[model samples]
Target: MSSALSTVIIIAALLAAAYSLVTALRDRAMGWDHLAALGVLEALLVAQMAVGFVKLAGDGKGPDDTATFVGYLIGVVIIPVVSAGWGLLERTRWGPGVIVVACLAVAVMVVRLGQLWEGAVV
Candidate 1:
């Protein structure tokens, strides 16, 4: 995985989290803006996943903990989608709160993903 891409993903996730936090603070339900931010995040995650898969396909290209890294990649991609669905189901401020949690999770996971890619054990 490219560190630059990982950094971008992390920043985007944090921004999304902040946005969701603001929406939740305002006592508003998740709306189109939140969904759009999530959509962008999902797209970035998908791109990251694609790059990870391509790297893994090459001979001995990924980290020693390949299985775990792969798991993280898949999880990062799925989290936003699942959270978005859950958020949409609730018509309350908690909906955006859910997104906030998801975005923060994604940010942390991306950082972990970078460490995994570098074979850092933690």
Candidate 2:
């Protein structure tokens, strides 16, 4: 895994979380901008997935628990898409609030991804 790319994903996830939180706090419901942000995050995650697979395929020096690593990657990739869908189901601020939670969850997953890449287990 590229540290630079990891850092970029982490930072972008954090920013998405912050933006969603602020929107939720302001009682702003889901909007185009929020969806756009989710779209951007989704793009980043897809890129990460591609890079991760390439790295795993090339060296096979990643986490011992392949299932978990791949699971996290897959889950992270699907989250924003699912959240965006859920957000559309409602017109309240809580819709966006749910997205905020999802963003934070993705951030945490990114941290875990780093650890797993480093061969940590629990």
Candidate 3:
């Protein structure tokens, strides 16, 4: 896995979380601004996923729990999409709250990915 890409994803995820949380705190509904920030995060995550797959396939060096790692990778990618959709449907401050949840999940998954990259078990 590429540490630099992972760091980018992690930082972006956290920033997304902070942005969403602030919006929620301000009692604002979901808007293009929130979507734009999360869109940037999603783009970075997509790049991270692509690079991750390349690394996994290249030289065959990966975590012991390959299935679990892959599962987390997939789940991390899905979270933002699902949460965004949910937010759009809800149409309230809860929309940003949903983003906060999604971003936090992605942030945690990024750390987990790093742990898995380092050969951590389970």
Q: Best candidate, TM-score-wise?
A: 1
Q: What is candidate 2's CA lDDT for residue 4?
A: 81
Using lDDT as the measure, what is the rank order of every candidate, best first? 1, 2, 3
Residue 70's lDDT within candidate 3 is 89
Instruction: Supply candidate 2's per-residue lDDT for 64.
Output: 82
- Tens digit per residue, CA lDDT, model 2, 18-118: 88788889988899988888988889899999988888889847788888899998999999999999988878988988898888889889889888988
Best by lDDT: 1
lDDT of each: 0.93, 0.86, 0.85
TM-score between candidate 3 and the true structure: 0.93
Give candidate 2 regions above 4 Å deviation.
none
Taking all chains together, each candidate's TM-score versus the true structure is 0.97, 0.94, 0.93
What is the lDDT, from 0 to 100, of the residue 4 in candidate 1? 88
Per-residue lDDT of candidate 3, residues 1-122 (tens digit): 77888888889888888988898899988888877878888898888888778878985678888898888888888888888888888787899999998998898998899899888765
Across residues 33-109, which tens digit of lDDT does each residue of candidate 1 receive? Answer: 88999999999999999999999998586799889999999999999999999999989999999999999999999
